[model samples]
Target: MNESYKIISSSILYWFSQKKWFVYSILIALFLLSLSTPVGLTLPAYHSLIILVLVFILVTFEPIPFPAIALLTLVLQVVLGVAPPNEVASSFMNDAVLFVMGSLMFAIAIVHQGLDIRLARMIIYFFGKSKRLFLMGLMTISAILSSFLGEHTVIAIMLPIGLSVIKNIDTQKTDGKNAVLLTLFSVAYGTIIGSIGTPSGGARNVIMINYLQEFSNVNIDYWKWMKHAYPILIIQLLVAYFVLQFTFPSSLKNIQIKGFKKKVQASDTKKNINHLFSCLIIVFIIFSWFTFNDKYGLGIIALAGALSFMIFGMISWEEINKNTNWGVILLFAATISLGFQINETGASSWLVLKFNDLLEALPSNSFNISWSIMAIISGLTANFFTSSATVSLIGPMAIELQPTDITFALSSAIASGFSFLTVISSPTAMILYSTGLVSTKLFFRVGILMFSISIIILYLMSQFYWINI
Candidate 1:
């Protein structure tokens, strides 16, 4: 009996050691739950805030799987009386969630068709003259494609092209390694910067749009979104090019290629009529997004595109199921639901009041200064958390910051796309890191510079450019 008790105790201790983050989150939640509600906030609102804290801890550490975290969010909402079961159910699934699901599926379809190979050929055709031009072209093309598609989709497609280029080089030398790192970083950061250019560019953009319409009644369409965000995208791309060049200098001036062109051409010949059909389908989807997104939400249009790909036999359902990350979709849905509850329970308004109180303490908390502060917070938060999750949580407070001015909301949404600070901040960064060429130390070093410049560019655009548009 003594030996059995010791074994049981050891097992329990081992389990606790493995799951300390989870235990810490629960204890924090309980401690907060035991406190009296804040003077101005309702019980439900206060409980929602506690859930928010719990979620931040869980997501930051990821003590459990993402789908489990998503399910816990829904369960906590009902259990804590933040909302009724029916309301929770309604909020769990929405157009934003659908868009995320469809976009992931869409990326699989595009890559499955092997269009990325053809895209690589075009990049080499246009900018194969000089090493600097090739790097610039990669960044420019990635930014352009990602503005319409998405960072995940563009990076998935562009990574292979960059790798193909790097494969032809000698990585044992310092210049060759720098060239490789520069190419990969260009693809990653360009895709990230361009993801803010349109409503369809990233799921976080769609989430912000949904929140804007649902909470603030501000109806911004695809073109309007592009008008506000595209200039900043262009500016960031240019700045990133120089920053990347400075960080990873390569003195080898000429493109040294023997048979890559011939190899790409040989693969191009294998493309049949199905590839043409795929191109047509993508063009139609982009047209629909630009022309009819106001009539049909971006989610429905994205779903329609995915369905088209399946109907035409361009991609199989199994392919999508195998490639898509469903946990992210569910987590986006859950966090979005929490965001809605935060607003409905008046928690966001209370937060805005408290924030305003803090802002007032500063000597020069002008409108521009306030906007910059919120954008900086959103960008910083996005660096630690997924951009979609950051928006799902921080977006409501932004809308509440200035109920009358939409600039505050737009800045927050756009700034959240600046996720260049960490490897896990965006999928593009993760994909780049997976190549094993870019070290974590080097990634963070360049990211600090890119993130800082991007924030400054965003501030300038908001002050000078967005107002005119």
Candidate 2:
């Protein structure tokens, strides 16, 4: 009897490990039952839970972009009585969604013209041109680009360069494993960290901020976001650098290859003109932001920039049609729509009740320690849900915990941005994983280290930079 029980348990564990769907389906069924039962969940909350489950299923099993999934989910919610039929019509269209679409499309245009290459080479020229220095240089450039362009665009721009450099290093029979892995990670992580700096950096940042404003009236504006978030981002970058240094092979030395000059020069020419113009437009946008916050939202300015680029033929109509991430947009919309319902219905509140119970068990006044713990917890939870979705789901609860402590609320949001260790964590990871530059274990190891070190940095920075315990 004992042997049979052990064998059965082991078999179930093995089955779950190989087929994740079995586990997810079981949990989803449970969530549904809790909702359908007299458990007192609101209709909107139930709808959001169902959509949330479906979103994960799509990401891991079916794989569709957010926008498409969002559109379909909204339709089905209305049709099937998940959400109110009248209210469902306008759920997907919002300033935030348009802002994301505009930023993504504009970034695609700018990167397509080789703008990233122009600056990447310039950084190499000025920052000194050794192999490791070039890697760091490219990483710095990626972070800067991602702050405005979106991390997905940062990867799109740097990925080709990263591949070329690694292939060149390997052409001479040198082991390229560490170099390849480092380059891919540096680019991916740079964008991931950089995205924390602004509303436009990653949609998650925007999502978190929007939810905050909706729940609590303490508006975090564009410049306000950078005021504190940039400090955290800089700390995270340092952490990523040292962690990468340790992970890199000891035998690997910086091999200065002047051979990449042709690539660099062409890249500069292709990107420089567009880059200069784009930079100017970005400057204009920033100025307009400070000068015109009440008159025009950032979304309008971003849309204006995208439209201007299109009119000037910097991006052809065909390119717009081809390069747009329609699926990501759809998925984001569905998640947002459903997330709104969840937040409204107080489902997230009950979920936080469970999290708060865990926190209360820690101590009487370990507020700082508790919030830091929550930061890491929020980030890990994002692995199962998206950063944006997780943030929206849990951020309100985090803020409400120590209502006097704004630091806890905001820091928790920033920490959730560091989902670098798994291809399953964020859209950026999914994008990089599909590139096939490194193995899953390599990506996982690199990501785990990066994330761990980043949490430490955030913890320390919170001590010095943020408010009291």
Candidate 3:
């Protein structure tokens, strides 16, 4: 019996080593659990959210490409009668999804035009010549881009430059490489922080708005989201700055180092007509993001941009078709379908009941304990789950619990930003991770420290946002 158990354990480990199996197994497990839970009306509806969350975790972490995992969950949902096939297909066409796609393509165009690099140089020029100031430029600029354009795009454009800067400085042993890592993370963190500042910043923020409107009376507009979120985001940026500086080698931290002047190598780089048009179409799409975005819907806008970019000039339609990650898109659509199913089937409500029941098990008279606990829960949960989903699931419920003071509500909301446990929680974090520039373990190390510090920063901000500090 012991031998059999050992063999089984070994097999499971072996399967997990293959990223696909690891992801699929996780989804299957979550699906079964959600289905069995007494949380919702139909197993398909309530169970779908649980399944979707699992899919989001897998895809965001990028152990597997998003497109593939998306299909599995989405297809499975339809086949299992969790969602109708047409509904599953339509989930792929959401405005939120298109908005993300348009943002990504626009970011690509900026890089292709060398605009991002030029912008980086400008940042360094303005900051002055000191290692500390250099670090500041790196973090601030990256943050700005990540917040507005996107973290992944910013990272993709900046990673090569960051590496080049250190390489020129003989950064190998002098903590130049560490500086690169810090810059990379700073960009990712900034993008994430910045994303909350705008409605188009990340999928979750939009989803939160939609979910709130759909399920409750709360209606958060794009501008209002910025107003409530920006202040908190600014505070996050400051925390990121000090934490990044102190955590890494002091020699490289927050330095305004010498900026790059090297031109792209003509040989190592090739610019094609297809690449050009691909980029142009991306630009057109971005233009539409603010203009025609709502008219046609986000998914249509993204597809239009992607299709037009493919047909335009950067690369051949075949080449663009070949290079793009369809699997990631598929995965995104699938997760949406699954998430909706979970909510519809009533599983979410069931879980809420259980949670409330669990809360009943514990004495909860003091607002302090409730707020602290909510903060901890929000931070920790979002580390593994998507931030928006975490907010949607916990936010309304937290409010429903009826904290004695506004402090608890603010704490719970801000604590949702503590998504540093894994790259999957935040899109910007995922984008940076996918660059293949930084390793998973390095991210793990940084994430742990960030999570720890986030607690203190959120606590401090609570004082400001709620007048507690």
Question: Can you write out model 3's per-residue Cα lDDT over 1-469, one digit (the tens) per residue?
Answer: 6999999998988767867655676767656675454533566754565565566456445666566666667667776677688877765566655554555554454455454445555666776466566656766676655544555566776666556555543335547566666666665676556655555555555555544544454655545555656677777788888877666664564233443544432212344444444455555655665566445654466557555544545434554445444554454445544555555666656655666666677876454555567788878877777665565455544544442343444455556666677767765567667867666677778778777776776676665554632
Question: What TM-score do all the candidates reach, one by one?
Answer: 0.96, 0.83, 0.73
CA lDDT scores, all candidates in order: 0.87, 0.69, 0.59
* lDDT by residue (tens digit), candidate 2, 291-408: 6644565666667767878887788878987988777676666666766666666766766665677767866747666776788887887765667666655666676665555676
Kindly list the per-residue Cα lDDT of model 1 for residues 281-325, writing each as its tens digit.
889999999998988888888888889999987778988998899
Locate the minimum summed-lDDT window of 10 residues in model 1: 252-261
Q: How close is candidate 3 to the true structure, as a TM-score?
A: 0.73
Tell me how candidate 3 scores on lDDT.
0.59
lDDT minimum window of 10 residues, candidate 3 = 264-273
Task: For model 2, give the RMSD to the true fold.
Answer: 6.4
- Clashes in model 2: which pairs? 65-327, 66-327, 66-330, 66-331, 67-329, 67-330, 67-331, 68-330, 70-334, 114-271
**What is candidate 2's TM-score against the reference?**
0.83
User: Clashing residue pairs in candidate 1, if any?
Assistant: none
Q: Looking at model 2, how many pairs of residues clash?
A: 10
